[model samples]
Target chain A: MFNFEITALGNMFFGLTVLVFVSLFFVPNKHRSVTLYSLLFASLACIFYASDLITLFIGWEIMGWSSYFLIAKTADKQTLQKYIVFNIGGAFTLLGAIILIYGACGSFVYSELDFSAVPSGQVTAITILLLLTLFVKSGIMPFHYWVVDSYSQSNDLFSAVLSAIISKTGVFAFILIFFQIITVQYLQTPILEVVAWLGVLTSIIATFKAINEDEAKRLLAYSSIAQVGYIVTILSIMGSLSLEAALYHTVIHTFVKLLLFINVAAIIYVSKQHRFSTLGGLLYKYPLNFILLVVGIISLAGMPPLGGFSSKFLIYTALLEEHKGLLLAAVLFSSASAFLYCYKLVYGIYLGQPTNPKTEAYPRIPLRFYVPQILGAVILITLGTIPGVIVPMFNGILGSVGFEPVLYRGVFVLGSDFASFNGGVVIGAFGLIFVLILLFFVRLKNRSVKPKDRLDISYCGEVPRADVNLHYGYGMGRELSRIGLIKMILSRSSHALWQRVSTLFGDLSGITQKLYTLSAQNMGLVIFAFFTILLYMGVK
Target chain B: MQKGFVAYNNEQKSLEAETEGIKNSQTLIQKAMNWFSARSMFVVAYGTGCGAIEMPPVFTSRYDIERLGVVGVATPRQADIMIVSGYCSLKTLRRVIRTYEQMSEPKYVIALGSCTINGGMYWDSYNTIKKLEEYIGVDMYVAGCMPRPEALIEGFVKLQESIRNNTIQPGYVKYREDYAYYQANQEKLLGKETQPVYEEDYAGMNLS
Candidate 1:
């Protein structure tokens, strides 16, 4: 059956995709193809609008393989293998779920499928399979072995697209299938709790890993995983308010990641440095880019008066509504610790002393690089400034799907039964206080004498000569690795574990291939023997 | 002589006049700025000699120099004063010049002990610089073989008073007005670079 339609969820994603694609337009990449990118955009649209499982599955595989080729342009053989194997494995699981649904209800269309007819055991299998696909696509942990290498190794512009848009396909798929199609009653509460804990734990571990990383893109890749982890956690709550929280966080995260990846791209473009140790003192050299990066990190860290904090607030309130006290405490702990990596990101590139004298000659960031960052900053601030406006839109999203708006009361306040605050007053107060402090500092003295040179630091009665690596970028987070639990978390390699898994699968395939290499008579004898053994067991 | 030096001298003289005019006028804003800058002193936490041992007691709860609004900062960028805690060997002298230059303007130096004043016990030593002022500016001096924390505190208080009252030309200003004299003296002892050269230059280019 061919089926297609549009819903509020589709519209939100369409708008986001447009925003991302426009920003992606400004990025320069040698491997970029207009035709291929258009194919990707069209396939995503198909997935968003498809009303049938087969149509959705077709779109999903197309998106997967197309992005694989895109990543293949820059990635080495190992990275390419990881990318394809993990993505195709995810696709296969999705296909399994679809096949199960068809066999149970005998329908591929969402409106025609009757889930009640399916046995409880079969339904749980479908849920697990669907969740597996979604986790792999979303780069959720245990399934996230492919994400870091692919994101970091991909071409600079493509990395932005990967983090900002491609990874969110799983989130959209989860909302569409789990919320719209499947009734939540079939899912066990314990399973949802496990998922929620998995998400929060992934975030905590990723934050520490980000701090430990020296490569700029790798750090951002870990940061992307961590931010997406929050969305996954909130969605596991599966309430109407929680749905709103997930969508809200998704919007904020998409913009934040887009801004951050592009900013890093600009840095890479000029300085030609990948590791934080090689990059420093570019703050003044590229002041606008630095400011934009700070804006991105502020939002990424979920600080107040940025759009990041707004979504984070919604997530907390949604959890509180469910009385997930312990889960909320863990979420709070992760958010607090994220500040360390955020500081590390800024300090490594911008704040410290420049180790290279040639940083003075680094080219200015092109005007096009500013386009997306400024757009992102403007939107985030506007969202933060008018916090009440988006709530009604989230409410409208529920109404569009014929879902009841049981809880939403007003524009600013959330969770009437639980704690709520007027967001307008909070934002206004913060804005006013910020202005006052800024004015006080600016009105003071204006006698800042520049140092003789960059190397003129207080080095215990000796000058740091030009050749010494004065930049603290490499050593900034080496302290946290000394701590007990974080050290354990950072030291464990998921990639190595997955490597053993791949090797085992390789050996299994080798044995099967040897069975086929036998002559025709041998193959026939093997089949006959297998059937005879099966028949004897049946008779018994 | 280069006309550039004459032009620089003229600019420097007018700048000094402007500072003097500001000092004489002493508007409420200027006074407020001076008072705050003098009251909240950030001493660069570096030590060259034996007097460094006496610093912890002053900074910590023992002598509690923090009561007088003087606190030690980790870097020269944020520091208002650098305490040359003891005698400077040629090695330490290079660092002192670098640190003093790095400090932001309206900065001062406190030469601690007789070592910095006239080389003290290191007067006859080959490596020691006899007078610290030849290499960098010294705003105040506490001239004991090993000055106690109380004497160091007194030196800080007196320096703060002089800064607040505008009663003396600050050493930072003097350094700025007469940089050539200091650099020449430093080069005489420290060779042409006036910076510690290591690591990068150690390998002979003839390695190939």
Candidate 2:
């Protein structure tokens, strides 16, 4: 009998147990919870590394249940209940896939199971089922409705952990499916191509939704889906380079998202403003924090020299290498469209005028605030600069997955024929040169000119009124919507779909809940009607 | 297996060393080494409510917020702008007040979404506050239930307008005045007074 490794399973169990306890604390003081959650995540990573199917299944269930509870801590009772139901459904599907594999091969161990021995149809079914389960967890399109409600509703700290670690269980599942179950012949079908297309579609739709979103946390939730779409598109390429790029993106994304979420929490914690309409002109007040947040946002946006660009570049190269023209164009368009949202984030909060005159005083940011994000930002920049350091480790991972090794050629330059500097060297040199220029500028400036608060000039003869309420809203996406042709495709709103679904489910559940309260005779009559209907159908 | 462990351990140490080289450190040697590293500014990670939807692009690859000096800060003390995106519930208001209290002074508040201003669709809802002025003051309001990212961008520009104008300043005196008016009004209007759960009164409590 194939048995789960007790050690690995226990690790997952420990993580889940810890998460349950961690959910009890409040924000800004959830350092204890963060510590425990980190431990739990570590345990999970180990279980995934262990890699026996039974062990994997155990770890999977543990991670799902743990994260479900994490979502529960901040979500309303209804949303939490829905989150649990959706998660359980995904978990059960995963269990079924494992059972099917065992039934076919008479083994649950991942290494010994031979996918080639199984029929192509069965393999396809298993792959699809597994993908469904993972997609549900990863917040892929059509299956992603629960994420925003769950994440946005949850406590800020809980949201950070959920976004960072829990959602990634799907990526781990994808890894297993790509390497262990599906072969190249199977992946070459139009089905994989369809999956890639779906990712592109999801990204486009989710980005627009994010652009128009008002709730800060909800916007992040939608952004999470968009980022996941990028990963899905790359992973569906089924090439070694693409897979590696996907991994890179996943790693970078996890940390960047964590930083972003925590930063959101810090803002909410300090400012007492959860809506952007009421917040502005904080950059001057909290210069240190503004700078740190900029680091996180830049890294997230895939700016050149930050961690985001590295992964995006890799994914683009992989797509180009495969000569997937349409996908490349979609990526390009998506990349260009990203600017609108990024500028919104920057200009919306810090760069604008202060409408609320009372918020001029800067509140204290806790020491813990800087520690985690600083560490994350550092890691992102480091990875972006010197990817070669991690190349060997990825190579080992590729070996384990039975993929060929690949190298990262640095950015290139055109010469008489062809000449290129390594990306690391070229980027590193420019970065150095830029830093030198900035330093020179800083040094050249007169120290005697003590910087004072800069204000807007009152133009003309008119005295500027303080209460005109300066803010930019409603017009953020007008240009992009009109210009990008996204208006046609992204017109389908998730909120509308979910609203309809919630209404339907609300009615169905209402009826079901009242079913048992009926008299015994009534219940019997209902059962009789059901049976009669089934019999009539069978007979027909 | 032991050899594999050793090799992995060695690799890990080297990675840490290289990482430390690029990271911000106080030591002179470390600073000298980091001169070549790319400089990035901080951004306050403030999400009000629905308006927060626009933040992803700024932080993500499309807009690349790093070219500018903005980054996401994780705490109130470090943050510069507090971006409130949309509407606020009574439940959320309590936390928001506490968070605002925690942030270091010289902070900014950017309110995103129309709900934060006049409560939008939730204006009549008992749970939501119609006038944000009644509670914590706001700096900039990006008007929309969910404002577009471009609107948020424009809001940021407007916020910059205020900041450069030197019009933005702490208004604790106004809050104090409003609080006093609120207290007196509550006593007169409601007869029995119920203090705000989030804020503290300057005068001593009525023990009797």
Candidate 3:
């Protein structure tokens, strides 16, 4: 029998991920009822619940293969290849670290491992390997090449699952291994500092990449990476507040992505279009979906009156408290730049003039699509209105993990030792102002004049013909590439680095193949020569 | 025939007299509402021709139209006024009509330049419509080959006064009353496929 222990951190993530996975039941995917997806969910549960390295690794492998097959159902060969390659690479790195830990500790149980008793050098080596695995899964830059392709190419609903839940497994593993087992105090400070910088840098670069992407899901994929980057950065701080901030962000990101990806998936289902350039003027046709997307983006942009703001506020406060001025500045820059992409996501699909003439003829979105979006929106709104409701949960998790509980009390108010705010007041003030403005607008005697034709837009005195391209979606973010810093960032490609590595591997494989292909007598001579040299050196 | 014509003229005159009397009897609340609408005019900046060149300067640092509570809005749903700032080619006329109709009630159209009034130099051109009022309502016209920013500002001020005093029938009111006429003209030029049938009006009719 395998030992299984449940912690607050793992239980919360597992519950939320499974909840989202289950809520996706309404989405009528071809693979919706498939056993593989359930198996994937089950394996993730196992990983979350595992008390020992052996059981964790077994669950991790199951998760990798199950998701691979699930993605293989829809994705092309190349995408599948990329997914398998990167994920297997991560799994191997994880296995290496686990084996090393077992070798050193003489036990596979997480609680049995004591890194303080191990040599400092071996501890550093194990930590690096574990970090590598986490970095690959979480998609920190340079190692993030496969993320965009895998995310963009996966099944629409599965893409949401992949982003919202699966990626956070890496964060879960990080907490379990680093904070719980190894303990942060024993980790090298210099290496952790580098990890912090890597996190912020990844967000900055990923934000620019997201802005330039034309495909809606790909843009979202990059946005997901950037968001996770923030989580990684805050986690690197290794403080109680920072841990709370990380957990808060984890919950916020999951809901925001679930809502947004499902919203985009709905649009894609209706219009049969995935590119922003082809999808526009959808708001009137899908008002409910559009509103849900707006809620999602508002939260995603970390604006006030939404749950995104609370987590963002905590993260900034944590950074400020630590006096990480430079890191804080970079994070602020990334957050500010996020507004552009958030606007693009909405405007690309909903706000602008219709691009395709046949867009109006598209079928109505099914009610099933709204299920996940509404769930996400409700959770976001509730969290926004009463952030303190979740704080106690986080505090319990922190206590289990040997961190201080956040100094917050009351149902709607969230506070730290340094600063705090009442979420209810924020929501109340915003609602009052919104209602007042809406009432004033309604009370005005002005009547609405409906346009007879979609083409009835002002184009001077001249009329825009049917052939005219009125959609501004594609053009909205094009100018961002002209900015100095953004231009440099956009001009570079991580693909080149990956390509060079592949070519080097290809050449090395070729050289080894040639050696193996040599005649048996030549191979025997080479082997004897090698042994003789080894034996002579040993005698010397 | 002559007696009938004379009777019709008399009836028209009496109707005008009644409307004039009603206009003069406006209450203080109505006056204040007009003032409020006038003070905060959201303009849908539709640049149709050469006159559009002058608008950017007016709205920017040089002229600063913001001082007058005039703001530029992106969509017609939020706008109170549509500025038709140049020649009305047939293609542009279609869009202008659409943009005009999209605006909410109490909306105003400020037609700028000689091109909008009489097609300017494009009068003989095959594509440009010579008169803009035939297709849609025109509340005010600022005349120039290309109106200067100051002249455009003056036109806005005059339009504001007319709105505040209820001195003239607004264009949107005329549009609602004579929609059939406008639709006929629009269809004649742009073809019947140019616009969709109004859902509200067609709901009761069993066209199928």
Per-candidate TM vs. native? 0.86, 0.63, 0.84
Ranking by TM-score, best first? 1, 3, 2
User: Per-prediction interface RMSD?
Assistant: 8.0, 17.7, 4.8
Q: Per-residue lDDT of A1-540 in model 3, one digit per residue for the tens?
A: 367898898899998877798789889686664789888888898899999998888888898888888888888887887788888999999999999998888889988888768988888899899988888889987778888888988889999998999889888888888889999878998888988999999998999899888899999999999999999999999889999999999999999999999999999888889998998898899999999999999999999889999999999999999999999999999999999999999999998888888987999899999888999999899888898678889999999999888758678887697899899999899899999999999997554446567766555434567778788878877897888888999999888887888899999999988877888899889999999999999999
At residue A312, what lDDT does model 1 achieve?
A: 88
Task: Kindly report the root-mean-square deviation of model 2 from the true structure over all alpha carbons.
Answer: 21.7
The predicted structure with the larger DockQ, 2 or 3, is: 3
Q: Candidate 2 regions off by >4 Å? A: A1-27, A30-43, A408-421, A432-455, A458-462, A473-475, A481-484, A488-491, A498-540, B1-208
> For residues A233-280, could you state the per-residue lDDT of candidate 1 as single tens digits?
999999877888888888888899889888999888888888888888
The whole-model lDDT of each prediction reads: 0.82, 0.64, 0.85
Tell me, by TM-score, which candidate is best: 1
Please provide, for model 3 over B1-208, each residue's C-alpha lDDT reduced to its tens digit, 9 standing for 90 to 100.
1221111111334545645765678888877888998899999988988889989988899999988889999887679998888997777777788777667667899888888877889989999988787787787777887678988887777778767776666766665667788788888898986563353452243320
Q: After superposition, how far is residue A3 of candidate 2 from its true place, in Å?
A: 6.1
Top candidate, metric DockQ:
1
User: On a 0 to 100 scale, what is the lDDT of residue A328 in model 3?
Assistant: 98
Q: Which pairs of residues collide in candidate 1?
A: A461-B95, A462-B95
